[model samples]
Target: MPDSDLLLIGLGNPGAKYDFNRHNVGFLIIDELARRWGFSLSAGKWQSQSCRERKWGSRVLMVKPQTFMNRSGQAVAEFAKFYKIPLQHIIVIHDDLDMHPGRLKLVQGGGAGGHNGIRSITQSLGGNDFFRLKIGIGRPGRGEVHPEIPVESYVLSNMGAEEQEILESRFDPIEEGLRTFIESGVAKAMSLINSIK
Candidate 1:
């Protein structure tokens, strides 16, 4: 494939049990992208559900790995190898607990920040060089509900209605940020997305 071809992977666990969890924000974003771009990831392959579409004159492969969150790198590596997509041309979307709810960050070549899915991908790819679109799910604060809960439990929990509303309201901006990333590249995307409150 040409350098213009891109691979977009959304990290999430499979099965209905995880469909609405905070960690499944990547899956939600993938669904929104498909809806906006007119593609269906109904086909299963490479341990994922995938679809290809032409976007900004380049072929974009959207994939949701079914290998679960921890082993996501296996699916990502397989797809990247098969498509010959370079690390810079790959983008992974997943949830972030460090940022406040509804905030988004577009970053490149960074540490996993304790995210198991990202850690797996970094290890499998031999580096942390891929672009990431991180959707903030927020962490427990002092005196907040479940402040004593485990991080794993918090991430696996479903989003409250208010939190879901906040996320839904930012979908348009997130979509625009993704478009900017695909058209103008990661630096531009990071500048634009990180500027958003």
Candidate 2:
């Protein structure tokens, strides 16, 4: 059993090849958090890699689902069920194509907005009440090599140098905002993250 009821899940397709893809921003955030916290992830029975630590008076379980992007909920559901964690206590971090790169939005209880991972989690958890930290990756445009790349291909592709730098620069703020979330709640976190220019 888990010592804490709070859970944080980062969404991405598992494997080295997809490491820097636009769809893997959540995983990148998880990796950065792990680096900053000095924690390490280990394979878990729920088909996820995770680390646990007490932060801000909460025993937080940070997880990276290994069940791939679409099936992420399978691992998340297993862990949540085993830990007996409530929906409101769970937070998911994922990429969003609707907003420009480097943008972040923290919110609770909403639709998936066409994200398969969020949709899967909502379906498996039987509700959309969980919190979400959205990292914007933006939609592809005609300036790229392909005149019209499909959304799937665009997201699965690795991020360009400029985009990568922009996103990386926001990591510090993201960390601060997440700390706010852990220390307070989604509302405060949203105020901090969403205000980032």
Candidate 3:
């Protein structure tokens, strides 16, 4: 049996300014759960902001890296090592442009695609053996990319009110997914949520 309690790490650029962006949905989910369960993420440790909570008799540690998006792995790796968490016990929650809004995907051990945060984590951990909970952000509108702009700016930028409305509705299922991940396992959570439209 895995001795390490599952560690759920939310990926995003930290700070008030970056809070509401499409890329920050992972952080938003953690924030929503914290609010619902009354946990404080004000603590600074493991190069990230984190909170510890008791849920369904399991100890849950929710992490948000303060190291910005591109270099998120440093904090994550440290947290995993310091807490003695095995790769099998860590779950990363992040935004995915590929999945449509209100869609959720859960996977174990995969490449980071073009996500700098996941890339960094993989680099730091020296492998892609960790669990991932990908929340959809959808791709940008037609012809939005241009020369000379950094992806960092694009990801950290906030979504509009209409976009936010769509995402705002997704919080419930995502919250349930977290609970299910703890109560059941990744396989059960995947079967339950992915089976939804």
* Highest TM-score scorer: 1
Model 1 C-alpha lDDT per residue in residues 45-85, reported as the tens digit of each score: 77899998888767899999898899999989988888888
After superposing candidate 3 on the true structure, give the runs of residues whose Cα lies further than 4 Å from its correct spot.
1-4, 141-153
Tell me each candidate's TM-score: 0.93, 0.92, 0.88
- lDDT comparing candidate 1 with the true structure: 0.86
Cα lDDT tens digits, model 2, 10-96, are: 999999999999999999989988998888999967888998888767788899999999999988888889888999889899999
- Note the Cα lDDT for every prediction shown: 0.86, 0.87, 0.79
Candidate ranking (TM-score, best to worst): 1, 2, 3
Enumerate residue pairs that collide in model 2. Answer: none
* Residue-level error in angstroms, candidate 3, position 137: 1.2
| Model 3 Cα lDDT, one tens digit per residue, 1-197 | 22237788998887898899878888888888888888989768867889776776677888999888899999989888887888877888898877766577888988888999999999999888888988776665524432344555656778778767777677777778767877777777888667544
Best by lDDT: 2
